[model samples]
Target: MDQDLNVVRGDSPDWRPPNKLLGQYLLSRLKLHGDRIIQAYPQYNETVTAAVVAERAVRYAATLQSLGVGCGDRVVVCCGIHPHYSSLLLGTICCGAACATLNNKFDSGDLRRLMEIIQPKVVFSMSDAVPQLQPALSQLATIPKLIVLDDEDTWKWFINNKIAYHEPQGIDPYTNVAAIMCSSGTSGLPKAVQITQANLFTSLMAFKHKDAYVQADDIVVITSPLFWVTALLYSLASMDHGVLLVLEFGASEEHVLGVIQQQKATVLFTASNFALSIAKQPSLNSYDFSRLRIVIATGTAMAMDTQILVENFFGASVVQLYGMTEILIATGMTRKGQRILGSVGLLVPTMKLKIVDPNTGISQGCGKVGELLFKGPQVSPGYLNNPEATAATFDAEGWVHSGDIGYADSDGNIFVTGRIKDIMKYRGHHVSPIELESILLSHPEVLEAAVIGVPHPTDVEHPRAYVVLKPGASVTADSLAELVASQVAEHKWLHGGVCFVNSLPKSPTGKIIRSELRYLTES
Candidate 1:
């Protein structure tokens, strides 16, 4: 196992799975920790226990059953961070239906396109989301039945008019789809990722791997959107592992940090951009983060210096979980110098990893960078109904071709260099923007940075940078360019030039929208 084989067979302790549907497992956990306080929404001023959430789920399931909904049906949920979100998620599972997230973050146009792709039998909408969903629903050829969750009369009836029911038995874990998530990695339109029962089951357990695991009584401050995987995991973990989940409506730095301090949260699950926003907040020093134990960062490559600063600020180690919305690629914890600083730890023990040259089909050896492809039960089966995308991404051999550019050392430590399309071509050399961006982020005054390939007549394209500086810090573009020039090769220097911007464009989820930056260069 230690011969530096390019193909590493994932191995870890006690990964044997329990034979039950994800729904059944969820139901059991709900009963097991019925009295535990599982959810908190500071904005809503609500603190709910497992028992109350489960009752709502049971009623929601009963309502579904009365409406003839059952296994193999689709339910489009746009509840948008409400108190009923957990119950709706659990209720769909309890009824053997797959829930697709198209929360309020999406506009009417987004809903129109997604609804066409999903074609669900039922639309679960809260009052807050009706404005978006209704317009889209009206234009559909066969409009799905819209069920508003916040309708007081409907909820009162659903709660009072009890239909005695039990969870459907005999779910084939491997084939049955659990949930459909809409993912748009860095740019382009969104695609629906189909997560099977087995995939979700394996993902949950993979998070519990010994290197980094969540225990009972741990308060997890969730900053990700409810549709995103981190939010789903933390919500479910509240029931399964007896952890306390602190929830939030998306995108407000003050409220999120205050929740962490008020709740005395121990674990933080977030993306690199959101984490940086927290780091840049003027009021950050006022808060007491002494209770924070682990900061789990994902979505992009975290710069080493920024990682160190975040670690020192929170007084906790930053554990990077590298994967797209499609799958969780790799994660491991730190012990002194046991982990490489910039590396995204080892491949998840339940999955197998191999770096493959994108141009050729050949496997890459240790320390050779290539496109990473992984295989495991946790890996998604494919995109729902989008056969072309599914075929292009997931191969016949079960390897999910990750478009990410990365390499693995002999220790199986994965280092994500950049994305396939993002690598800039300069003077016949491949220049990684992530590599340059990482170096740019290391500067003390740089609040945020994004790198792109600005077109050049002779050299295919040249690397350009857009930077946001901290308030009152006046570091010039030349010093920043020199910083990158000293660290990387001459060709990888910011040849197109550096532009100091007031702020960088970001998605609602806080991911840098590189397309917008590229647009700025053209404009």
Candidate 2:
């Protein structure tokens, strides 16, 4: 037996840790902005005040407690963008249990796979998503208590049985899991990234220091699903900043623009492609977006020209954010008037970024492209129950070896070229899929584009493009090939040719599925 392994050392240096849990922090916001309307849903024509939200969250937590949920239990939220998502998530965390979010877009098979992994204690599904979830829930060995968010009977049961609000005592914020958000499954199946309470608080603090920091009385709108880590961060940021958050489930371009005009939303958070959609929508001029001061594009990289177009049209500053589930909001651009093309902006506060050779472990100097390694308090502890992946991705010093390839200039502006796995090799020359995709997006006729390397006879590999054109827009493949060739080197040119598709496959967060494109090109 390894008796010495369990030995405890003498008193060691103790550092300051976040004193509050994720739910407690958000609950405090209610006291600060009790009278203000903190959440508005234009779709339902409903508005909820901060005080009301706090009360609802407490009651919801009591309901979970009454149902025998306690510390370390997993509560899965399987629904679309509902107004009650914030309350449910806060309630789950308030009970000292972790909240796992699942998108309603998942089918029965997908749900079954994820359910087998998470093994949640309770599952909260909106009335609309219950049908889709039933099959998966039935197949589980032990059925979790199902609570439908929109059902009147469920609400009555929770409200009648609700107890007094009780703050979880002796909870360690650093070790307590806060939420389990799924990674973008671009290369493979999505892994459950376990974010701790400390990580969530640190992420909030980092965004608090940025130029796009949420302001008091600000009306913020997020277009992405609550399941996405970025959108969840925005939700928490809104509460931390005492801002009114407006949400519309399955928001279309028209719905988003209309909500902004009607609500006079001051800040917008959305996927880069959604922002581009708003800019390209023919009815954009019909909506008034003058109240918008800051717009953040996340999920995927936005073409510099597309950023300019959105900024010009909305009369708001557009900044691109580079982050993932593993490390939430690591880097973001916040320049108000000036625009930096192809830059994700300066490193976020309390974070350190280093570039190192992917093959060799040697560090790369500034302005050199290599894999980005990030060390920060906001980084996730690791993927859940996946020690092999955890060991491969995280290091002894707590640095997350991000598989992204990028570089920082002398001015400290970060430029993400592409993912290390997404880089295309042509005759031994490296080609950035992002570079080709960005150029293709700049074309007037192209609506969406994805680039991947395909097998070649002469060169070891060749660049291929899958494109989606604007409605009623016309452009030949050869012309598109010439357009890219003029911008990049010969080796990086589109030698594998272009395929026009109705739509490019995308992850839930709107990142293009490059692996799927590669599969299509090869097979």
Per-residue alpha-carbon lDDT of candidate 2 for residues 1-523, written as tens digits (9 for 90 to 100): 0122211111121334446677887899777888788778787788878787788789989888877778877889987776777788888889998899998888777888788777788898888888888888888898888988788897568656748767778888888998998874223566788988888887777655535446666888887787888767866776677778887647678878889999998989888877876776555678888899988888776667767777877888788888878988887734453447768887676667777789996777767888888877788998888777777888887877878888877666777888888888998899988878878877878878888888878898888899999888879999999999998799989999999999988777676777788777767
Q: What overall lDDT goes with each candidate model?
A: 0.79, 0.78
Q: What tens-digit string does per-residue lDDT give for candidate 1 at 97-207?
A: 888877676888888888888888788778888898888888878777787777987656655767866778777878877688888633457888887877777777755
Task: State the displacement of the C-alpha of residue 12, model 2, in Å, after optimal TM-score superposition.
Answer: 24
RMSD of 2: 5.8
Name the candidate that leads on TM-score: 1
Q: Which ten residues in a row have the lowest lDDT in candidate 1?
A: 328-337
Q: How good is model 2 by TM-score?
A: 0.92
Q: List the residue pairs that clash in candidate 2.
A: none
Measured with C-alpha atoms, the lDDT of residue 487 in candidate 2 is 86
Using all chains and alpha carbons, the TM-scores for the candidates as numbered come to: 0.95, 0.92
